[model samples]
Target: MKALLLAGGLGTRLRPLTENLPKPMAPVGNRPWLEHLLLHLKREGIDEFVIAVKHYPEIIQNHLGDGSRFGVQIEYAIEQSLLGTAGAIKNAESLLSDRFLVVNADIIHEVSILPLVEYHIQHKGLVTIGLTEVEDPSHYGVVQQTDNGEIVRFVEKPKQDEAPSRRINAGIYVMEKEALQWIPKNKAVSIEKETFPLLIEKNVGVFGKIINGYWMDMGTNERYRKVHWDLLDRKCSFPLKEKEQGNGIWVGKDVQIGSGVLFLPPVLIGDQVHIGERSVIGPYAVIGDGCTIGKHVRCSETILWDDCKVHDSAQLSNCIFGYDLELGASHILYQAVMNRTAGVLQG
Candidate 1:
């Protein structure tokens, strides 16, 4: 099956991080966040892809070029202007098969696609939206489905008290070609707001398939940190490059650890990392490749991306450092989130 990946949003919620990189390009573990999605879909037996991109298309193009590295075939459909959800798919309509999968690129999920496709085939629906339950459905596109699995309507971000159901749209869908014609050409359209409503109005078959595993939208600071912790906690099936170094610690090559350094379990220090004596790290610390931790440093519940350098006596807790940022000596911080750029958030 051909899957259409919507990779072109402005990603304003992620702010400075998305200033230089696309939201889908955000790092999950050692690999790009979007790589997890592609590999997950590929594992479910979907190897063909149509990536619709608008912002920083080249980064995504250069990274996942031809999809050969991931054992898949990929085609690019670049949109000149901002096209909303449905419009992006409409823009790539020619590249898609008669029936295809449409997935939001910023999402991280492990829902099986083959089962959703099989459900769509059995129901014979023009569209089948993957739904997942959440405590607060008000912020998401709420879905109401009949007992027979037919989706009745879509209420986009309704008030919590007025919501019809807790099953919200998971941004994965099985859509048919017939649904594309309903969306106008060269115009911004939202699949949840416009296309699905119109498809329902026409009395066409629209269904819902409940997802059974992990799902998250990598769109904010907290969510970004959560994904990394989730990856470390073994919540998802993403592969890691580092090897286990015993005592709940994972390390990469050429790691230099000074004596008297205390590791508190569940820590991952990447390649070429240097930790000075008397430094305490972890119980949920992720030090990226080439990072330098000086003496008397304390780091926990933090994810430092590649090349971040922390000077002597620095303490970082509940923090995330972007690439190549520095924490001066004797500095202490908690709950600081720095974007993956020059913008440093310090105490």
Candidate 2:
């Protein structure tokens, strides 16, 4: 089945980081965060994808290209204006055929999606939304379903006291082509606010498929860091290259380690990285590709993206540094997170 990835949001919560790059391109672990999503979908036999882009479209276009590297065929639907979730799908109507799956680019989940697709096909419902039980349903669009899994009510961000169920929308859906008829073209429309509710109003068939698994919305610095650690900690399942035992540490190809370095593990270093001497790394640190670390540095619980440079004696803990950034000597960056261009968080 073809998939539609919603990647147009401004990523306001991630600030400083999304200030330059799109949220989908934000670095997570060793590669672009969106790569993980694409890879996940690829494994599910959904190799054809259409990404809807608005913010910094060129950057996403340049990075993903035709998606050949990941063994998928990718097409882009550029929105000149900000189109809401349903609107974006409506805009890409010409490319979509039959039933399709829609996913949010910023969401990371390791749930088995095969069942959800099968459920949608079996019910032949107008739409089937993936639901997950959350402790706090007030912050999300809660779904109230019948015993047979048919959605009975659609509540969009109801108050905690007013919510009928704790099951919230997972921002993933399977919809028949006819569902697109409910959404208008060339206008801002939200599936949660406009389309889904309208379907319910018209007494159309809508169902919910609940899944229990590791899921996170990487829309903030803390969650972004947590997601990376979750992957490293084996809390979430994603396709990633594993490192085997090596001298003092496990480093990827083309790595440059300088002299006088004090290394520690459970650390994973990516390709084309440079590390300076007298530096202490890890006890859970992930350095991305093409990074340059200067002398006498200390990093723990930190992640650095490609081409990032840490100057002499800089200390980074519980932080994420974006691409091509340079840190000054003795720069102590804690809980610092960035998006595209360099912007430091004091906290």
Candidate 3:
């Protein structure tokens, strides 16, 4: 089956981090966020993907490169201008099969697509939206459905008092190609605001599948960090490497740990990482590939991307150090995301 990955959002919420990098490219577990989504779909027996992209499309193309290395065929539908959710799918219409799965790029989820697809096929619905109950429905696209799973209404970001149901759109769907005809071509259109409402008004079949699994829309810095922390804390059952050594720390190949160093659990030390003597790392830290840490440096709840260097006596807590960043001696950071080019580096 083919899947259309809606990756066209400009990511206005995740600023600075999304300045050069697209939101879908945000790092989670030492890999691009979209990579996780793609691999997850790949494991579910979907091989072909059509990625609808607009902002920073080249970066995705450069990294994924036809998706051959990942054992999938990738095709991109680049929108020259901004198109809303439904419009982006409309832009990629020709590439989609008669029926295809659509998923949002920013979500970190573990719901199985096979069951959703099977249900859609059996019912022959125009659209089957994957729904998950959220504690707060005011910020999401809420849906009202019958007890039998037929969707009756969709409220996009309803007020607290006006919300009809806690089941919100999980940003995953099984959509028939015929549904694309309802969306106008070359225009910004929201499926929630335009197409789905029209479908219901026209008496088209639209259903909801209340999927039971981990789901989080990592659209904010807090939620983004929370996704990583949740995975590290074992709050979700997403596939990730397990600890092979002391204290639930997942260390990579050729990692060097100096004497007298301290490491807390749930830390992931990437390939070829070097830590100096008496350094303290982790309690939810991710040291990316080829990083070098100086003596007595401390890192907790931090993420150091590939090839970064930290000088002696440096301390970091609740921070993210981007690729190739260099930390001067005695530098300290708390609750900030820093990259080498962002000018937050302390000399």
Candidate 4:
């Protein structure tokens, strides 16, 4: 089945890291975040995709470039202006001529798409939204569904005391072509704030299904770091290309570890990485491709993107380094996110 990926948001919550790059282009492990999502969906039998893009669309277009390298066919729908969730889909209506999967690019998951499609077909609903349970429904749009999977209503961030259910919109939807009729043209519209509620009020066929899978919204800096930890811990079933050393160390090719360097397990070192002598790395550290670390450097719970350099005696804990950035010698970095921009450094 074809999938419509909504990837147009400004990535406000993940700023600095995404200031120069689009969120979809941000590095996740050794690959771009969008590439990871695309490959995962490809495994689920989706070979055709319509990627709705807006903010920094050129970066995404340049990276994916028709998706042939990833064994998928991609069609880009570039929105000239900011469009809300539903409006983005509306912008790509021409490409979706049948029942297609709609996904918000902010989420990464291993949801079984076929099962959700099947569920949508069995109920004969115009749209079936995937729902997942979270501890706090106060921050998300909660859905009320009947015992038989029919969606009754939606509550946008209800107070904890009045929350109808813990299940919130999973940002995955299976929509029929006919459902496009309800969304008006040439305007911004939110799927949660306007479209779905309108469908319910009009007595249209809208349903919800509780889905089981590993799901995370990597929309914030905290959540972005957490996704790495979750993946490294094997909490999800998504495929990774790293070689596991059976001692909690996963490394890519040509990774060099200097003598006397101490490592705590659950450490991931990417291609062409160098760890200098006497450096203590990880318990939860990810060294991105082409990174160089000097002697006696200490890194704990740190994630560095490609080509970053840490000079001698540097200490990094709970820090995120963006592409091609460098830390001077003897620098002590903690709980900070740094990204390079226009040949300058930002922290």
What TM-score fits each model? 0.95, 0.92, 0.95, 0.96
TM-score of 4: 0.96
What does candidate 2's lDDT look like per residue over 121-146, in tens digits? 89878899998888888888888888
Q: Write the per-residue lDDT of candidate 1 for residues 169-280, one digit (tens) a residue.
A: 8999999998898998889998888989899989789899898888988788898888878877888768777888785688999999999999998888899999999999
> Weakest 10 consecutive residues, lDDT, candidate 4?
338-347
lDDT of each: 0.87, 0.83, 0.86, 0.87
Better of 1 and 2 by TM-score: 1
Clashing pairs in 3: none
Model 3 off-target regions past 4 Å?
Answer: 241-243
lDDT by residue for model 4 over 186-264, one digit each (tens)? 7899989899999888877899888878899999889999998987887875666678886878888898889999989
- The runs of at least 3 residues in candidate 2 whose Cα sits more than 4 Å from the true structure, single-residue gaps closed, are 158-162, 246-250, 343-347
Q: How do all the candidates rank in terms of lDDT, highest first? A: 4, 1, 3, 2
TM-score of 2: 0.92
Model 2 clashing residue pairs (backbone): 17-338, 17-339, 260-278
